[model samples]
Target: MDRHNVELNRERPLATPTDLASDAVRDIGAGLNGLLADVFALYLKTKNFHWHMSGPHFRDYHLLLDEHGSQIFEMTDEIAERGRKLGATSLRSIGHISRLQRILDNDSDFVSPEDMLSELRDDNKQLVAILRQLHEMTSSYNDHATTSVIENWIDEAERRSWFLFEMTRRSL
Candidate 1:
């Protein structure tokens, strides 16, 4: 192969064969990778809060965060695999994830339990919006499998948000 051909090949490795067209693969892959990055960021933040939890609600808040963290982490593998199945390369490293992730990180030395729950609730709502957008795009391409998976994720995110919201709310 000529130098130009060699460089092109290196940059765009042969994609795994799939029914998705090149455009669909490109668009969906990019979307999935971005979502995956956000998921990782959120998972870590959830864990951080869980570890740092204190005060009267320590046990309850810690356990809630642990459960939320696990649920967030569970989506990472499926998201990456789905991208690969669509013939698109997924996130390769922490640096790559940092570059693509939209979710903000919390690095404070101390975040109150209420604040942690509130932030996570907002983040989960943000995730639901992203999932909804991806679902619409995937459906437009007739990618029913990806859309179905996203639907379940959307429901899960909403539930997480609901729990977080309730935890932070004042008793009436």
Candidate 2:
């Protein structure tokens, strides 16, 4: 490897100052970055289950996972762009995502259909709580732009959770 630009990273400040204090921008951006990473992880896991899912309800389960995964993936771009708008360089790679992500990754081992639905439901529920926490932080810092974006994300996440939970109640 060339091993160049090493010093650039060390010297790069988190974000350019805006209406919000530099500290506040950095803080809010960091929170968004973490949220973005978790959402990305969750999206991947949801897709994985979608692909690997088996059993009598395969079509319904697959479609549900696919839809939810798309929603989660959609959130990542907005979150990352918001971070960039704040001048923060968001996540750079999958390794970075993994480092900041809150969602757990599942291996290839077989999981029962119900187990998959339950796991995703719980994960989405956890994600909603995280979004609320970030929203509060953004509110406290008067980062209304971030807060506004978070509200929509929370709604999407909650919807995903609702769908997952509903999947659990009706069929095996």
Candidate 3:
């Protein structure tokens, strides 16, 4: 049978168990959606920087951006999976991402190493802020799994942002 045509012969609707567990799941889903949006935006910006970055620190900055991009990409997948675990569909497309994300796009053609580092630092900081908010929401809902994931991601992002800032400062 076609997947779309295959239907379960059940008498009742499949209610989401998370609804009974608590409103925390719903709240966590919402926060995770927001966090996913931010992560996607940051991922794009990091890749852009990786491609366009130039200076005495070209090689180093490029490598750093690539690593950061990979981390953000992994976080995006984790957040999306969390959304699914909470009984909702994950928003994984560019349109969904653009609609939900709050981060502004950097459309400039060529970006200096300093500018790239600054942008990444700002993006990471913003991500950390969003993660912190999500952490509070998850904690309120008593969602330990989601809270722990958010905490780890927040710490990593913050550390990366601080390192980027320090590098920029030393370059000055």
CA lDDT of every candidate: 0.92, 0.86, 0.80
Better of 2 and 3 by TM-score: 2
Per-residue C-alpha lDDT of model 1 across residues 1-172, encoded as one tens digit per residue: 6897677668777566678888999999999999999999999999999999999989988998999999999999999999998889989899999999999999999998888889999999999999999999999999999999999999999999998888878831
Task: List pairs with backbone clashes in candidate 1.
Answer: none
Scanning candidate 1 in windows of ten residues, the lowest lDDT window is 8-17
TM value for model 1: 0.91
Per-residue lDDT value at 107 in model 3: 95
Best by TM-score: 1
- TM for every model, in the order presented, reads 0.91, 0.88, 0.86
Local accuracy of candidate 2 as per-residue lDDT tens digits, 92-133: 999999899998998958988899999899999999999999
Q: Could you say which candidate leads in lDDT?
A: 1
Worst 10 residues of 3 by lDDT: 8-17
- For residue 74, model 3's alpha carbon misses the true position, in angstroms, by 1.0
CA lDDT of 85 in candidate 3?
73
Alpha-carbon lDDT of model 3:
0.80
C-alpha lDDT of candidate 1 relative to the true structure: 0.92
